[model samples]
Target chain A: MSEGEIIIRAEGLTKVYRRTSGGKGFLGLFRRRTEEVRGLTDAGFEIRRGEVVGLLGPNGAGKSTTVKLLTGILTADGGACGVMGRTPWLERRKIAADIGAVFGQRMQLWWDVPVLDSFRLLRDIYSVPEARWKARLDELTDALELGGILQVPMRQLSLGQRMRAELCGSLLHEPSILFLDEPTIGLDAVSKLRLRDFLRAENRERGTTILLTTHDMADMLALCPRVLVLGRGRLLYDGGLDALLRRYDTEHTLRCVFDGGAEPEGLPPSVGVRREGEAWTLTFAPAEIPVGEVLAKLLAAGPVRELTLKEQDTDRLVARMYADLKLT
Target chain B: MNIRAYRTAFAVHARQVSRYRGAALGGMVTQAFFGVMLVALYEALAGEGDLLRETATYVWLQQIFFRAFFSTGGEIYEQIMSGSVCYSLLRPVDLHLWCVCREMAAKIVGVTMRLLPMILIQFVLPESWRMLPPDSPVAFVRFALSLLTGFLVIAQVNMITAAVTMRTLDNKGFSGLINLVMMILAGNIVPLTLAPERLQAVLRWQPFAQMLDAPIRMWLHAGPAGEWALSFGVQLAWLAGLTVFSRCLWGRGIRRIELQGG
Candidate 1:
């Protein structure tokens, strides 16, 4: 798997958990026990070698189930998923050997043991060779700034520190493909930035294929260039973050700082204003009016000292897509 | 389990149980409270009021084996409730084997730390323990193997209960109901011989009688020691049965996991 290409190829991968009528009493309760709760249905997507794909979705959109299916932790009743040319469910052990997953809601560390002990156990669990485990552990520890707390038991570490330790546990095997399920959730700003940097470095340096699913849109912005959108167990879109923006009627803000407290005016009809104390920001749909034409008109009117262009967050763009798909 | 692998997991859990002092004492209190209550009731009924030939000896056995078996698997309930069962799902070790190995180690440390203090306290109250005669060696080496086997059986039953946790969200129906049946039918507060004939016949063959009350009965009187051998033997029988059953259920349950991806 180290040198191989085409890491993931999943087709018509569907899962349905029969939405049983729960909270029913007596006569209804027994009948509901046997009812199926339909969860995911006919979901399909793929990832190429060395690609980082962010899985974007709302709650109950079947993103985690899809990751579980690919990770071989959950078996799919229909469709086929191949990771590194092996059927994940049938070849679960082999598939596990080639991939690592960090679920955000759970901690992988042994709570009573030192973080290093959990790290070492993971090393043994994955059977990582001594030299590789040391190198990778050191690199991740340093990049994520986990040196001081390594000897502390996991129960003693704060949430951010524990999350960093979890990231190390997942990567100890040096698995070619990594699934990060909300690695940055509940992290402080500094921790989040450090996590993103570590991810970017490892991906660039080792070409590790990453499939990240996060509610934090900042995760998508800082790490993934490509995103897969799932809603109501359906694939809404699969492309770059930029392309998702285009699809969602995305808004971009033009911060026009004028010279000597002079306010700028006469923007295009397509542009709408966002207010500040002395400065006014304008937002427009670029697909409706091209950037150069809009800029030509705006720049022609005022002495726009410094212009800052910012787009709607990847999170908002993804949210709008999910709403359009009616999953939320 | 390979001895080496079980050794590592055993050592880890043993250390963890030892480090948590308050929880250990709390467990001892809970186990001892139940222990003292059972012994008190039996002492009140000894041979004429005589429940047995020796009331104090019977009480000591109650303390030892009740604490051993009843307190065996508190963690199992916690594991099932909290979804930490997901941790061992795909591991190379059989989940039941791993749980039994770790829990047995925990029981060894906890019971050892706990058992002696409880015995000493019961011994100091000589008026309460005149039947034991104060020289019992516990037949420690022999009882260790029997108790270990007994403990494995106890823990395996817990695994079977835990296995259902993954399948159903509501577990109030399983363990509570089983505990209730075991208390009456398995003879926890009373002797199996004292129970009705048909019920004792069924209890003798069932696993719960072996888990709690049987071992305590044997330690009190060795005439039942040979009978206790059947209990240990049944323990192995259940170890094998529940392990296979839990594995089959686990495989089925995991196949249907909602994962409920977000």
Candidate 2:
């Protein structure tokens, strides 16, 4: 598929899990109950080739269900989805050749075997040509800094090393589309940065389309330019990540540790002030009151010992978004 | 057919199975002890001559190939239980054939490691208690072929169990139940030959009998050619039937998992 071509498209996609419960006693077995749990409902979106898209949501907000549906691991109970011009569920085998998925919490590589052996098995599984396989392996191992650990068994590797090995294994066939679910989970700062760098390079050089689902906002900010947000099994937002963040990025805070002084007065009523143990925190929306105005008012409170201006924590921003959408 | 891919999976599983040399050694000692005890018991109970010798041989063979009944498809169960089965289903290769290859590799390699050592245990025993040789060279050849067919049947059985596990999620209960049935019916618990005359006809023809009971009987006595063909026919029929049934069940199980979330 060419760049900008619609590679993944879903319309009115939905999934409901009927959980059977309350079948404890002999009589209860006859009166068992099934609770319908919504996974995703009427979700619609279009992802073009070579785009890095992040899926964002609170826990149980259908983020995983969306990925599973698009990857053909789970079929939609209602509506339809197409990946690479073919229905994903119907042509899963065909699409399997073109798509690679990595679940952060799971290891796809053989646990007891050396990493290279697992890669060889994957090469055969995807039927990648020997020459292409060699080149891809070399490139991935070099880029992921996995050359030193190729001979190490998967179970022996550290979490970061294993994640890198998994990435290499999934990319060995040079699939056009890559789905990563929490790929940066449990990684150190250096490893996460390296992962993001490699992913950015992969997208740039190979035009590999990436669909990522991560709870890490740093990862989202670093990798994905666009995002699809799901809440309570509904599509809440789909647009640029900046736009989504900006919508929730209304509030800014200024914390001041004053040297024995009275609280700030004469500030606008919109600014929220909370004092604890001589440190006064001033929280206000930038849209409603300017940062300079808040800072000026805080200066008038007393001689400040230490002052820190902070943007909203991405995690808190997400929490706020979840609250705004009633997804908590 | 993706022969290369399946072969690669087989090799990997074989390597993995061979890694547990310690477990195999421990198991060999236990099996040898059982073999001696069973041989002694049979020698005391059965009448002297072909019947005693045949029973002793049957006990030895059962003890030697005990690993064959084990489901080497542990990886299949692990994948399903841990939800990593998603990656397995995502592979472009045929899932059922991949599982079969894995189990076959594990079974063959696992049994081969202890087969010779366990067979040698017979030499240390007294002549009367020792396992007797096959009826003839031709009989030995037939026994080998039939034994291999038995492995395939067991692999299919393992596949069917795996399909059930896909839905049940916990295979311990089902596998325990099935293992007990397989042991009694396949003559691992007690040789079917010792069973009453009335049940022998039906028991010998059952699918579980096709695993080892039928094959080892060939070694004891090579029946008429027509009888041999009939026995082979039963083994092959069960192998084919179980394979198709397991594959169909796996297809349905996959659909359920896809619809319900793994």
- The best candidate in terms of lDDT: 2
lDDT of 2: 0.89
Structure candidate 2, residue pairs in collision? none
Top DockQ hit: 2
lDDT of 1 by residue, A60-120 (tens): 7778877878877666778888999998767776666678778888766677778887776
Cα error, residue A97 of model 2, in Å, equals 1.0
Best candidate according to TM-score: 2
The clash count for each model shown is 16, 0
Candidate 2 docks at the CAPRI level of medium
Q: What DockQ does every candidate get?
A: 0.27, 0.69
